[model samples]
Target: MRLVFGLVLIAGVALAGGAVYMARDYIAQYQDQLARERQATKDALANVKSVPTVGVIVTNRAMKYGEPLVKDDVRIVNWPEDAIPEGSFVDMAILFPEDANGERFVLRAVEKDEALMKVKVTKPGQAAGLVSQIEKGMRAFAISVDVSSGVSGFLRPGDSVDVYWTGSVSREFEGGGGEITRLIQTNIELIAVDQIAGSDVTGATIARTVTVAATPEQIAALAQAQNTGQLSLALVGVQDDTVATAVEVDQRKLLNLKESAPAPAPVAEKVCTVNTRRGGEIVKTQIPCTN
Candidate 1:
């Protein structure tokens, strides 16, 4: 009985030693796994920090206060996919002179009521009004003429007219030959028949005066024509084939030239003394003969 009890005690000691050995192995394996996980986490963090950051480059010399932020003007710090929120105030460091550090620019939130952008730049010496002020082409003055004047009656705004001038003039040449007659001004534009005509004139029998858009020089020329010659408006109908021409005539001077023409010269009569002779006898006689 004593021998059996000693063998049982020995077996129990061996079992406890094997159990301790297995537990130590398990503990070591768990510690190695934990070390690997820590190394992996450090490697991931280092890779994230090593990634390059993107930035924007501005080409415009001046920027508005709240202009829409472009991607090239901004640089992502740690977060690459995030976008800068609208209404953010951007500093000058982000706008002017290239090569500024990313840390110099700070974005602050702007209120909803604030303006998003500004237009502060324009041509030199010109005042900036609205976007409408910058017209595309040269502008000219437009004259309005009543459509009721002869051709004006049928004229509509935008119809091209051949302006004619009519007047009277008398002229005396070095030899004193002159006459006068009436002159006419024709073929002037019927620009705006009414103030409310569309950009391009349209419609038939426009109720308002036809208006003509012309340069300042053209206006002066038209005024001169009107003053010198009784200006008459001629409508260029859709089918009118007559080409425009300018004519000046002086009625009184023309009439006077016709009346002042010199009369024809009178012929002179000659009286002749002739000698008369008979058939058989010669006789001398003096007689007055008219030829």
Candidate 2:
């Protein structure tokens, strides 16, 4: 009976050793897998950090038109260098100078996290007005427009339009003058309409006058056209890039009238006279000359 108990104990010891060996094998495989996953995670993070980035100044909160912008209104964020926006303020010093006497103002509405661009804000000590919006070497010309000529107030700042002139041309001009409508200018940009200059203007505004940014020569042409005839505005599509050719229409052209040729002048009849010397005064007789 003692030998039988000893053999049973030996069998139990063998089973326990086998279980420990299997557990060690399983643990070794699990540890290797965990180490591999950890290395993969580290490699991914390193690859992400390899890409270059740039620091760009962006607005921290929403900004409205003509709103003052202080240093606290913006913050620098790390942006992808390749995806950086044009005219973005990468340096805070350039955007807000230390010696500036006044703060800048927002020219247009900007949402949070939006890049602070030069076009979206006014310069230091500058006000957000028509003067700031005008381009260099360009003059702001005001055009009088009514409900029909103004596109029913669909116009907004920064919109492009074609100007038309409609009035009578005097008989002093060539081509037998009459009332005509002609396209004077195309693709002219409006900087302001009446007092509103913001491009984010909502709804239709029946403006009495609109200011346009034009070169000196263009301003002169527009001035003459406005004076000689009534000026009308036609809104141009945002995506339209085609230039309009010279267009003019008169009453004849509108009705597709065909002009007739002028008639020939009347020819004078030639007469032959025969003279008689029988008397003191010479007598002459008329006869038809042969052609």
Candidate 3:
């Protein structure tokens, strides 16, 4: 009987030892998993802190040109700090001041969620017009255009154009004489076409006059060119960065006619003069002479 009892007790002790070992193994695995999860969370937080951001004001809905920019029209969004655009309004106070004398107006069409930039909006209490659109140190000059000269009214504000002058040039000009077309200005920005100054113009507008933003020097050049000859606008492609060279085309060049060399002037016969004293006056006689 004593031997049977000892065997039962030893088996009971072995079972308890195995149970404890299993529980310890399970607990160790759980602790290791918890540590890994904690480390992963820390790594994720560190990555998030590496990037900087800024709050930029963007339009909540599509805004049109000349539309009033009220407080409800814009909202702040997190924008990448390094990628923030120039002239962007990041402060709400500056964009919409309480003591503002007048409301601000949109100068250009802005799409939904587009950043509200200083160049696209007018100052507080300012009206949206050619004056507001003109940049600092730039003057607004009007150029007269027709169907032939205006690119058929396909131009819109904010569009870049190359100005061509068509008129007669003196013989001293490099393009010979007669009426010729020459590219006088390249990449000139148009601010208004006729009475429409918005970039969201839908259809082709046959404009009579187009206003352009230019420096004083550019305005002077354009005024002189417009007065001296007919000014034509050639629409420049948005993606085109190539500058138009000294492009001049004459009637002869258009027809692929080579310039005929000017005829040499006939040499006058050499004259020999003889002076003779007669009374009180000197008389001169001309005689044919050799070369």
For all the candidates, what are their Cα RMSDs to the real structure? 21.6, 5.5, 8.7
Pitting candidate 1 against candidate 2, the one with the higher TM-score is 2
Candidate 1 on 29-121: residue-level lDDT in tens?
Answer: 999999999999999998885544333222232333223344354432322223433423244343433553322211122233332221222
- Model with the higher lDDT, candidate 2 or 3: 2
TM-score per prediction, in order, is 0.32, 0.77, 0.70
RMSD of 3: 8.7
Number of the top lDDT candidate? 2
Worst lDDT window (10 residues) for model 1? 101-110
What C-alpha lDDT values do all the predictions have?
0.46, 0.93, 0.92
| Steric clash pairs (candidate 2) | none
Error of 2 at 54 (Å): 1.3
Which structure is stronger by lDDT: 1 or 2? 2
Write model 2 residue lDDT over 191-289, tens digit each, in one string: 999998888888998999999999999999999998888999999999999999999999899999987888989998777999988768898999878
Superior by lDDT: candidate 1 or candidate 3: 3
By TM-score rank, best first, the candidates go 2, 3, 1
Model 2 alpha-carbon miss at residue 178, Å: 0.9
